[model samples]
Target chain A: MVDMISMPDDSTTAVDRALDAVLTRLAERAIPRGAAALALIRAASDATTGGKRFRPALVVAAFDAFDGDRGATPGLWDVAAAFELLHTAFVIHDDLIDRDIERRGVPNVGGTFRSRARSLGVADDGADRIGDAAAVLAGDILLYEAARLVAVADIAADQRVPLFGLLDDAVLVSAIGELADVEQAVVPGEPETTQLLSTAHDKTAVYSFCAPLAAGAVLAGADAGDRAVLMTVGADLGLAFQLVDDLIGTFGSEAQAGRDAGADLREAKRTPLISLARETSAWPQVSSALALAPTGPIAVRAAQRELHESGARDRLVALIGQTLASVRRRATELPTEPRALIERLATGIEGRIP
Target chain B: MVDMISMPDDSTTAVDRALDAVLTRLAERAIPRGAAALALIRAASDATTGGKRFRPALVVAAFDAFDGDRGATPGLWDVAAAFELLHTAFVIHDDLIDRDIERRGVPNVGGTFRSRARSLGVADDGADRIGDAAAVLAGDILLYEAARLVAVADIAADQRVPLFGLLDDAVLVSAIGELADVEQAVVPGEPETTQLLSTAHDKTAVYSFCAPLAAGAVLAGADAGDRAVLMTVGADLGLAFQLVDDLIGTFGSEAQAGRDAGADLREAKRTPLISLARETSAWPQVSSALALAPTGPIAVRAAQRELHESGARDRLVALIGQTLASVRRRATELPTEPRALIERLATGIEGRIP
Candidate 1:
């Protein structure tokens, strides 16, 4: 059923065009402001490039499923592009918070500016601060740019308010989720399982899944009931995706995940897996290994081995499986086209679990 | 003549109501999210409080001047509130970029979080990072909240797009201005007078004055010619206001300005005053004093004395006067009501010069 509509590739192309249009307009605006403005715009362009466009895909899928004349609607592409812009904004800020200078094996916005400042002979700390400021400004531009796109999108007047509301809700919820994540890191305690799962849901699921799906439904003039169903399905899918992502971050090969396998452990990030592992018998060895100086490869291996041997890995995998099943069940209430898309996305996420 | 419309007090009251309404709506949304979300909401409330409501006053004054109904429009209040929210967001982010943890003798949003984290046993740098994260999230929320208020406000549908565009332009321009400021600090070169003044205009004037006035004109359904006149007046007023602010930051008493007088010299900020001072005979003394470690009272006094003795302070003050005269001349092109308001506002700004 999903094959009837050629997804993702076509959707990705349309969204790219939409994004290009936005950048062109921004460039036109920046040119009059001078070189500094132009440089910031260029940095914005670089930061937004090369993402998988996952959120845009969900927006397109839901919009296509709900609207009969899907491909004919150019506004759908702008809507998709807005989600991608929002995602880029979040990614830039997240990198700044993590003090990470790289993303996707390249210099992120902060890293790029840090390098520029260093080349100009700024001290290390001064260069880092400049990089942080640039990242903040870049994120600010994209954040408002996303709202501006939605406000100007060629949709019905009545639909604009709801879409704006959805975007606002998503930003607020995601910020709270991020705050909780940061708090857990510095507050010196093990987060409860429910708190950990809720943090994952709020931080990752709401903006990435729920809002995009709902925004698509709103753009397509879907009824409230159908929109609610799609959002619930998105919630389940998003939670499952985050859990699987955490697993990949901890145990998957660097080549497969495109990130360091030991990063979460090195940072002592409290995830659902970590929360569960804290109660296991192998926790002592895992804790002691984590305590070793330098947190080298030996410690990471011992921690991973203990997690696997204690069955925490299996439990988390089971949790992910249950979450995906819930997505499938909730998706049944949506229309057939969206239901198929949701199930397919879930399956793709499931494939990430080792 | 300005007394015919009862000036800022009434406008301030209306703006307060609007800001309160925004906080009320935000609190209602946060209640269900948990304690962390509520803490964020509280921080936002604190951050938004106790400002002179300067931008909101501009919004209300311009709106009332254009619209005959005056105090009858509720949407005007929301519009005013939106500008205030925007201002608060900028202030928070600016403080973060400047590494300032205090504002107006109080702990800012970042400082509040940093203190909390420290009390909870986090080390200095870790607490600072946590605080930076909180400030980022807080600013993000207020930034979008500003847009959301504008989006949901009760106004003609067509007016919304232009207002959104105006807000978008202001945000982007202000960001570029901030980027230029950061770049100048790290790149280690004397900035041209034109560049310094341009940065001030972009960083302070557009969002602070032009956007608020233009937004008010839009809400009141004013003609394009009238709107352009007000924006031009805003540009001049904003430029003059910023020039005066820099002068005050350099030479005014702390009790009068409610800020540390020597802070700008200590930071070696590149304002028009500093740019002009670089060309004077006293440049050597000022430069050497600035290079002194600790940047204590002696260095600040020597720098300030050199600025005055070298005539740089007088030049900046004269520039401010000329800018204000230009604003008054431009006001002649606006309607009588708005013209009165603009002249009064410009006079108040002039009073700030030391």
Candidate 2:
């Protein structure tokens, strides 16, 4: 009856059910005073609509692996949902900062609101301002709502503080990561591999991976040593995941990625792959491709070819493999269920790169 | 030792001490990257400075008023500092949204960063982008720090959840208020008085007034009924505070307010005073004055004179009086210390206007 090998087999369905419950609660509560407030709420709701639910799965997987009778613990559902909502908030704000008009092959919260501004007959700059303002508010509210869900989760009273702290720390570290990203964009040369990796750790690893794992472990009243190990494993997994994401952003098909493939190049994002690519003689071509304002397919293909020729793609794949190997080594020290699940997660991340 | 009548007389010292402690911790924990991340942290630290610490004062006052051994509950200090930090985050973001160059008679976070970009030889648009990005990241980190402080406050385990909930609610409601404010600005005519007040309640009331009061009460383990009363009193006081703020923004000298005297009119902010003035026969003159591109001294004075002549100032004063009166009526239902503090706060708000 206790099938621990599958690790998050049913967690997705449970998490989705919980997310819908949260949406239902939000829908029932009327936003006071009128259409504008409602519009922000609608945008927020839309932002929470679709995502891969990867982070939440890690949370439930961690919780399930450590705690007994995982099916009996209902609080895991809310925690998972909260994690997804928090990710949505970050994505919305990230798009606004990058000035990207689309996400998941559709208009993002900012783009959708910008269209609304135009329909309202606002001037171009005016419409942009309105769109930006609306998206900022929407992101702000969603972040708050995410925390609120966690606070109200049916977890033990003593468990709530650490959980909330984990979420808060994620935001703080991610903000630092984002700031570093902006800085790297403005500077002349490419950021080194270590610097780029550190930013990825701060921005995506700790929050998207470590926090979820540590939070789930803490919620199950796990020991400090167990929690620390899980966190370490999560950090490595998260780094590997970010590397894979960069590869997809730089070289994957737009049809497969569901967004602009050349966005990283156009924005001159200093990803680890690009950082590694810059170390070779192909730096000039890579630099020019990145410098393109509205990066065309021709530029993207040229950049891809240059990166491949420089062996940067191979280097990135090897790096990802090394990270997963580290995760696997760390997993050996964990309990049976968690060890299996973590190894499976590592495999999943490894499979995503090419 | 209680000193009930002098609610929060020593709170400023305590709150300042705690705020300093927070900043010191932030400075010591090195962001593991480059100068840009460090610069954002520095800008965030600067943003936390020079404010009146108004919301923190409210939190301490409410706590001091109700709980015995007012100075003994050191957790109040952390709660107070958190409120102020939260306010700083909002102020930074608000300045970015409004594109304001100055705040408190000096360059704000955005302006300071923009100057940095210019000094770095970035062009005008690039500098603006850098400024906006930095401010947004700064605001995000500050908000996270604010919540983290509260989460780690020296309160009971059961008490932590509600305290965190209150902070989260404030952010959610305030975001809604901010959205309404943006919508009102973009629309053609002046916003109705009721709509303006609702926005005020959402923006200023929940965060500035109610959250502080309720947080203080929860820290003291106050009952639901007492908390409810404090929140209500806070709502009324917050509305009155906004009315006074609008008056100062409109008619007071820059020296008196530590900001531009006519910024509200310049931004075409639809304040309650302006709403009332628009009802008078002075509509055309007031409209033209508000529509001024630079809103030079001449136009500002003209707008001021028109408002005064239209009896808008008098009506605003009367409105403040009514709000304070309502606050007093509610204060009478509170315990002795809270009653005295509430009445005194009302008196102070009333004295702020002309």
Error of 2 at A200 (Å): 3.0
lDDT of 1 by residue, A1-354 (tens): 122223557667888999999888888999999876886788889988877777887788788778636745557888889988998888888888777899978988888888888888888888887888989998988888887788778777788788987897789888988888888877776779888888898888888989988988888888999888877877888788889888987888886667777667766677889888878887886677656613777778777887888788999999998998888888888888888878778878887775
Q: What is the two-chain DockQ of model 1?
A: 0.67
- For residues A134-227, could you state the per-residue lDDT of candidate 2 as single tens digits? 8777776667667667766777777877886688667777877876676566755556789888887777988888998888888767888988
The models' CA-based lDDT, in order, is: 0.82, 0.76
Error of 1 at A330 (Å): 2.3
Provide candidate 2's TM-score on chain A: 0.89
Model 1: CA > 4 A from native: A1-8, A71-73, A289-299, B1-10, B68-73, B285-302
Chain A vs. true chain A, TM-score per candidate?
0.93, 0.89
Off by over 4 Å in 2: A1-10, A27-30, A68-73, A260-269, A282-299, B1-10, B70-74, B118-121, B161-165, B266-268, B282-295
TM agreement with the true structure for every prediction: 0.94, 0.91
Q: Top model by TM-score, which number?
A: 1
Per-candidate DockQ values are: 0.67, 0.48
